[model samples]
Target chain A: MNDVTGMPQTAVVIGGGSDIALATLRLLAKRRLRAVVLLGRSAEALNEAAEQLRGAGVEEVTTEIFDVNDFSHASEVAEETVARLGTVDLVLVAAGFLGDASLEVIDPESVAHMIATNFTGPAAAMTAFSQRLLRQGFGRIVVLSSVAGVRVRRSNFVYGSAKAGLDGFAQGLDDALVKTGLSVMIVRPGFVHSKMTLGLKAAPMSTTPEAVAGAIVKGLESGASVVWAPSSLMWVFGILVHLPRRLWRLVPG
Target chain B: MIPGDTDAFVGWGNNNATRAVHRRPRNTKEIAALLEGSSMCIARGLGRAYGDAAQCAGGTVIDCTGLSEILAFDGSSGVVRVEAGCSLDQLSRYSVSRGWFVPVTPGTAFVTIGGAVAADVHGKNHHREGSIAGYIEELCLVTPDGPRIVGPDRDPELFWATCGGMGLTGVITEVALRLMPIATSYLSVDTDRARDLDACMEMLASGDERYRYSVAWIDAGTRGRALGRAVITRGDHARVEALAGTQRSIPLTYNPVQRLSVPFTPPVSMVNALTLPVFNSLWYHRAPKHRTDEIQTMSAFFYPLDMLRDWNRLYGPRGFTQYQMVVPFGQEHVVRYTIERLQEASCPSTLGVLKRFGAGDPAPLSFPMPGWTLALDIPLGSPSLAVALDDCDRHVAGAGGRVYLAKDGRMRPELMREMYPRIDQFLETCHRTDPDGLFVSDLSRRIGLTPTTPTQRKGMKP
Candidate 1:
């Protein structure tokens, strides 16, 4: 059971509104692990996600109506998550988005604020939660990185750069958690045409939210540090992310 | 040539179907090495089984492949006293040269003799020799209580239980059995083609009594009229004088080359709809139509396909599930119905083996009865795989048929409980010998093969 990564005994998914995050909660519940705490801004979405996870097989899932962006109350949310869940082993940080990528071209302040919400918010939330795991001497976290972070093309540099920062943070947390019996899985999904991608044109190597969710579970179970959507996109991004900035700019949109 | 107590553990033969890499103990004392606060252990033979029949799953598995020294053989009585590790095929080749052979063998001669006795295995000869249980004269078993020799006449209850206890009872170290006298190594085989699944069942059931071994290869992919097209094969050993010039050239002392590991995993599509169709076509065409021919070597006659090593891997990452179920004699229609349903669902199966049983010998949890059983291998693909098979399990149980324990992994405990009525009794013996559940297998955990959970028999009496 110790070898089992992630929070099997109790899990807290911070972005319950995200379908992929809710899917993870549901799967963990189905595995008969108790005390699932869904933390998100929308109480309705958190309650709905918790109910879905319970109905799917998670015998116990509680709702915590709190936003990750509220850094002042992040420690309180972590306490409530562990208090209700009893030894919360996992905290899935799945919040963040590509909110108005073109903003960097016109509004610099709005772009910075967007980056703070998408990257800084989750980083602060995770730091608050990680202390509890460090005290317990064991824990796992699944951080949602994005393919955009792998290569910040000019078309989406504003959103991509935020993910790039978050991705680096998750990797460092993963390295720091080692031998503490704590672990981190940074999932980098390519254009997962989910509810978030409703208006955007589907990217090449695009996959579904379900595929991303399934890959997250597989990666966590296999103790993989990182996972990419469409699976083959790992190699695709591996090469694309290393191209010279000028050469990267030449790639077709 | 062997010591008085040549530890009675079953060894791995050519069948590498177990997780011996997990635990390997040398003797009963050394075998006890894996107990780890557990009271007892079971000797695992060649893991040729399709399911948890060989594994203790969460417990220990002792590799017995090294215990295969054939201790002694009596020429006149055709009795071979061999270590548990010696296989039916090994015994056959060794005995046949001396004008003797193991009386009963499972379809795959790759199975060890200890496995034969433990499972009470039957073959094309089941209708005659009954089973390896009937031919088995004695079993030397080691329990937490220590080594005990049991036979039908010596310890009837323990004897019957150990016959099919799935290694839960104790370690079957050595087996003594009646070996059939053979004039030659070849079989005089005859092939008959059945038009459909129904025809195949009927043809095998009606005429299996006429030959020493009888089985049909079903083309599960066939639909409508061809839904069960099969090639039925039956044969008896060809006498030495009857052997042709070519067959006579094969010497009596020939040893088969052992199979090496699969060097590389082929692409996942190797056994897909397209490839399997071609393979099946080639296989069906290669059979000699209704020809009575003499074949050299039991390996070639009974295990020609064994040459293709790790054939199961051909199913790709979706590890293949082998479903072998036997229904009663009057229920050939039920067998046909099941096949029809599979065809209707368009479930791509790689293989289907159909055979007939003469009569049930009343081995408490014996899988076979007086009827037809069809074993099919389905590679896991869609989510429907489990649901589709659960339906098949219902149909089989409804027909008074049951899935072979050797091939089961994911059967529901409810179905298993209903299928094996004396399950409680089996557990009683398992606890009596292995108090700590040292022989738990993967199949046991999946199929709820252990003691019934409280929820299972909510209101029923214990």
Candidate 2:
């Protein structure tokens, strides 16, 4: 049994250990996805997470130590992971960094790190997987973007700007695969309280990781190309994107 | 805390909310691990026990819904082995197409197999078919020690104890159930209106034997003689030959679609003094005074509430409690007195269901007995409601009657003892199977099933 809707039974979670990724994996598991591969940095952490997903009833969860920072061999890793998991039905890109927003003026390296982690690395990895999905003639790729990317603000410009690049990349990639039997879902969430955002003060309309996972699942089931975490944020960002620069700068971090 | 993983759980009543660690474990191993990890733990299925029967405060709640699976089904023998998390809805959807149906189903098919076994739920057909426990052939229980397959003849005490033990004996991982073969999905129903409490009870008692399923919708709107006036509906599965035309083409159609929904909790309850009387009267007068052989869809006859999704939200933010009690055969007057009491107290009930129960199960905590069972869905916002229910409890206890634990949110521990005389036996079985006292829930602690420590439990009304 592959989900209540009888969708594909296999999936691969590229960025594992993050709260939203785990939450997304759980949703897929609930649909009785036959197999899932958690590709991440730490073996022990991935092993524990694999046990957790297995306990939650996923038939097979294979963990591999693959870092997103190792962007040179992104396609090689994707192929290996998909081969190990049997078939890659869906690929969820949730690996990103929300670097120090206050230090962008003092540090150029920190800003570049943010861009590499949030934009360049994931775009490259998803590109490799997208080619595989098209070759196979049917698959889904869900890229976790952010509302911060919708309209970058001075409060967190370094992180927000990086997400902006990733957001544009995801949308363009989605359009590129329109008729290739492969689909790309760009998920733009408002502030999500996951492990990455642990100590940060909550923002308005902040949603939970589970809520994001639920949205992603709904997106996958409905074949929606673009999905907003709280959905209402779609309209909220719609106005924010067109805000006058003077007013946008006045908004708080 | 993982926001979605850990949540404050409330029963179907949505009252007495408690903060508990909730984990939806997907397999039997996960269930076992959870039990082993948490000293104070309980298994929850669908969270449909109306109250805290499936919840534990400041403890781990292993949500068994993840383990839902229809392992195997034998068409010839009508035997099925399913994970405890399998909902009656899922089972019915699958089995009905194969010319089989769950032997017993509650008012709603949303309940799970484990929950059905744990509560030993009885349907309208209780007068004929007993509780869900009777149809169980065997069960796989995951205890702190490990999983064990217990059956009636193999481990009768553990099996019986686990049946109505409210998930206290252990977490029921899987169940091998005996399904009932049906010729068609439609029911040949008969509807009748009774003038008063006496007429309702008398009609149910006399005519119930002729039908496989029987239940009445009683009106608590009118006081005095008309207080318990009701519309009774009884039915049996329509045989294949009973189908007229298009129905014959698909004798086993198990499609239940939700056409409407109460999207969010309303600021005020939809059921009030102004609405209750009008709705009840409309419902009462709508029934044919005496209609028979009316072919009704199985979903319409068994689960009408399911068609309107989240109808519970209509009770408003405060939610409501479904107080279901069963009194012995000769003490049927208690039902009338309770109805009159509610009316006098000015406590309006949205809906009241009355059914005849025949014989008790071997499980000590099982609710049914050979007598009258009346269930009232009362909004919790009414201050007088709780007091009136207490009075009803005392009246029921005085007559050796008991309340269904599954539908209870707030019945006193002392009253529980009075209602279930063999509670000690159930506790003894719990101790024997789980000597460490690993399985416990808010319902168990609130009702003194486990040693009550005020610190372990919170949100109990004095």
Candidate 3:
């Protein structure tokens, strides 16, 4: 359960191997977070992240195999996680696929995989987790969306469209759970220098994984439904989202 | 069955509000029916609990206020058998004029008898007398197993569990409470101002046994030499000879009035960093250095905060958390450390109360012990507030103390066993009577007192 300050004591990260998710868990561990369950496709990466969290003062760390592309077992995975932990105070959805926009636009197979990883799979997993959280009567779900979803850019339209779907879905999920003990928080980082964005051109107001993790923790404490990393991106995207199509296209990626 | 009114219910702190179906049972049968119909529920009094002890999210909240009826009152024996919904205010008004008073009361008279029992409330005189649990002769608990009349001798395990059980044992339908006899409705109070933490503790430790009731109002905002400056007040019920009046007429008159009320919650807390230090300084300076035998009304001496209705709104819409913990008698340093930590963190506490507690009752979850307790009402806006309070929790638990469950909205579940060593026994008793854990509240869930699995009725969907 979350403590008096609304900081979660027990957390489950779906994309356990994700750099941003691990960073956020580390920060939460420093704030007295006791236990964590890391779920990801790679057993090696999940074990590494779990060891790091243990060293960060988390008393208990467990790893489970989870695949974003395996949509059939989403509900089962969520149920298993809850059954194993007894009570999960927070669930972090940080799985994403930043496929090559130029190549994925032409390759149907890659586009399908990217869409499933970024949108369909995560939405299914969150939906399943939300049911378990509702049964438990109290928990928070934080999904990592991106600024690219604010206005789907032509530069990475395939990835941006998938993020847009996820961003909208998370916002709606938050509203649907109103008055229930469950809440959904959406974190939109402008651009983070992590494994997923390695070698990619740094966007304006780009941030580090640690900075985004800090924002996520702050967002959880403040009970904000949507959090923008670097904070300035909220205003930056606010204006850019409304710009003319011709000017928007001319804006740098 | 009568339909319940669905609404949002918050504790007196006005934070952590949750939606629940509120059923006001007019009689025991109705209460039993409501309990039977709901998968999870808890009894609620006037909602005076500072936290979520009374609220059950996504479940039924049995509003016991409507079941208020004084069934029997023995004037000579001072034993009253009243329905659980009867408030201390109502009972005091009826009994005080008859030369009797409720044995124990919290900081307010608005609390229901049921709540007083559930929280095992202690008063200013706790160092001399124990909590309300000691005054309770018997309880008519309506659990899933049915109504059972339990007392100290009859089903002692269930009896002790029901007391200070946070309504988890069952809905307290009725309580047979032993009222204390009184000569008058007023008290003869002695006030003293202490310069620092050491002086205040010395004064209270040395003088508390001489008086029936004693408490200290601490100035937590002050630092350095002035740190923990306090106003210590000790009193006993004023006798007829002590009442300075015209022929001693109407000596037992007991009419308490609300002089002021906060009408609405402000956008920000009125008791914040800017105003807290000033209030504490003025409150400290306003106290008399040494005054003896000053006649005061019962309300003025005990329930002063009750004078202003909804005073919690002074903390604004964010509400406040009352961090009340008791360290054993020898561990006075924990009390000082707590106050110092709050001051260092800049978490302005509007009201700080320091009291000496006597031996605890048999109830496993009961909060009081032979210790010095400090309760601070801190507004919830400070960013560092959570970490600071967490630090206090560790220190209190380390020193063999525990936070009051009724007043706690946010406490770490892992520390529950460490603070309350008898928690496993308490849970065992609860499960024996309520196998499905029907009586559950947000506080129970937050503190890990309830069963781990989500409760589901036989035919109910999860």
Per candidate, the number of residue pairs that clash is 12, 3, 0
For model 2, what is the C-alpha lDDT against the true structure? 0.81
Tell me how far the alpha carbon of residue B26 in candidate 3 is from the true structure, in angstroms, after superposition.
Answer: 3.1
- Please give, for residues B120-180, the per-residue lDDT of candidate 3 as tens digits: 9999989989999998889899999789999999999999998999998999989999999
Q: List the candidate 2 regions with Cα displacement exceeding 4 Å.
A: A1-253, B1-5, B454-462
**Please, what are the lDDT tens digits per residue for candidate 2 over residues B249-326?**
999989898999989888888888999999999999899899999999999999999898888888776677788999
> For candidate 3, what is the DockQ?
0.25
Docking quality tier of candidate 2?
A: incorrect
Candidate number with greatest DockQ: 3
Per-residue C-alpha lDDT of model 1 across residues B292-364, encoded as one tens digit per residue:
7646567766776666666555655334557778877777777777677766666677668888776765456
Put down candidate 2 lDDT per residue, A223-247, tens digits, no spaces: 4678899999988888888889998
Each model's TM-score, in the order given?
0.71, 0.64, 0.88
Alpha-carbon deviation at B124 in model 3, angstroms: 0.3
Report how far residue B283 has shifted in candidate 1, in Å. Answer: 2.1
Task: Calculate DockQ per candidate and list them.
Answer: 0.08, 0.01, 0.25
